[model samples]
Target chain A: MNAAVLLINVMALAGILVAFMDDREKAILSIKIAFKGFMQILPVTLIILIVIALFLGFVSPENLSGFIGQQSGLGGILLIGVAGAIMHIPAILSFPLAASLLEKGISYTAVAALITTLTMIGTVTLPLEIRQLGKKFALLRNGISFVIAIVIALIVGVAMEATLWQ
Target chain B: MAISSQISNQQNLKDWISFGIVLLIAFVFLKIYPSKTGSVIEYFWQYTMEMVLILPAVMLIMGLFSVYVSNNMIEKYLGKYAGIKGMFLSFFLGSLPTGPLYVAFPIASHLLEKGARVSNVIIFLSAWACLKIPQELMEFQFLGWKFMFLRLFFTVILVIIMAKIIEYFFEITDDRL
Candidate 1:
């Protein structure tokens, strides 16, 4: 495994050990919770894995890059942002998908927009949010987030471009 | 609790159905293009292994945080603080690895009902949605540190601004009403 993965595993193990020392019952409960979470996410995880495989296998880099590459410009980024807002998936899984998109020549701007909107603006959860936080607040938060997601994407794109040139 | 469990059960069923459909599609695709099967499996296995390696650890961290960092503690902390300190506190509390964004809705609403500032509550919700610690780790693993850090930096700055703007809108609307 990579250092990042190793570090994460070590940190988790250390945390669990510390928890066990502090309160054995709570530590056990934490593990139970962790296991339940793992199970809960497993099906979604598998589906994403297969989808990624299909994407890589079937979708040509040329076609993908044509749609979301550097030349695709603001329109592509906006399209990606909207898609991200509408699509519902675990944030963790989005990273791998983003990486895949990047690998296939999708612009950093588009990927950033996708990740930002996917994480921030949840169209699927909008109704629930409105019910809890009121219609005005929910709509405003989501609307503002969508706009800012595109802004962040543009800035990220420029930053990455500068780094590459240097 | 019963209603929530039922809702979760329905969600679980939906996930399973989606999973089965995707599996069938994958199988059909492989059958249609036997030559591509090898590459498809290779990609699937690579990503699956990468995900499986880190997910358990990530979930463990989330679980520990959920159990130890009680919601009442968060309310106590964020409800009392105000101004810049409150914003930072909200970011910190929201960043703590916890359940999904939906789970944070109630806590955020409670904070508001308890008289937390609109900007702070918005920051809390936004941070919970995007700036989550575990989610950041996953981003770091899949995307490089530069990508993760840059996005995090921009997100923090912009989310704060957005929150303030949202708060301003609320104030004006409240005044008009």
Candidate 2:
């Protein structure tokens, strides 16, 4: 199993066992609080979660590694961001995709930028944004996102490069 | 929909026309800026595919909003709250919301009818598209925190600037639609 799943399952089992051990009322109360928190946020988050899930289902994380990540380092980094701008990986699948890519041969930098900026840098979504907002606003936001994504990716890349490349 | 818009079914005719023009501009741009890579198809595919999932959320959220947040409710909660509170309130609401960007427009129009300013609506819709926090969080978990932080920072700043620009244009044109 993936790290996320393993970690979540461990937490779930522990929480359930602990709750079962505690007074039923107290455990139920805590569960209620958790449910409330989820309700508060779920309205907004559910759709994004589903979309990300669907995206990962279709696109193999493995393909991403093959295309933009290989061993090119800096070039790969920029390419990933560029690819991300065009592609659209939801939040849910991004991790698994990243993990899978990294497992194969993607450098941390390229994967980082590609995954981060994928939604923000959308060439496809640009038309929609422009339709909703204006051209100038869309351009500014996208441009700034691209620049910021590059900087963040570089920082992550450098750190990973030092550790992994050597 | 305009007959031309329907017949042509080309919402972004300008995009196709200007795409070639933009190609030339890119040539000029490269001379000045010098980019490392030379293709955007992969990136295009990425965003397009992501939207595949987002589109349904758009329809669902649109229906939800239409039902839950009525015209009167928008006027009461969202009206006259235009400065920082308005900005943040709308920002949060927009981020949390899931639907097509247009879904918000009708509600905005209703609020405007009830007295919400265009600036507020523009900011709200813009933030809705950019400040999508739930999506961002999932992205962070999947992609990592680094990607999330940068996107949030840039999206916030971009929203602010775009909001102002939108406010300006609407002010000048008195365009409500």
For DockQ, the strongest prediction is 1
Tens-digit per-residue lDDT, A12-71, candidate 2: 446545655865665555455444333333332333333333334334556665566544
Q: CAPRI band of model 1? A: medium
Stretches of candidate 1 off by over 4 Å are: A164-166, B1-4, B175-177
Predicted structure with the largest TM-score when compared to the true one: 1
**Candidate 2 structure quality by residue, lDDT tens digits, B7-71:** 22243343345445655654554466444123233333454454333333333333333334454
Docking class of 2: incorrect
Model 2 has a DockQ score of 0.06
Per-candidate count of clashing residue pairs (backbone under 3 Å): 0, 16
Interface RMSD of each: 1.2, 13.5
Candidate 2's displacement at residue B115, Å, is 9.6
What TM-score against the true fold does each predicted structure earn?
0.97, 0.45
Q: How high is the TM-score of chain A in model 1?
A: 0.96
List where candidate 2 sits over 4 angstroms from the true fold.
A1-75, A88-95, A105-109, A125-145, A151-166, B1-79, B100-133, B140-177
CA lDDT, candidate 2, residue B70: 50
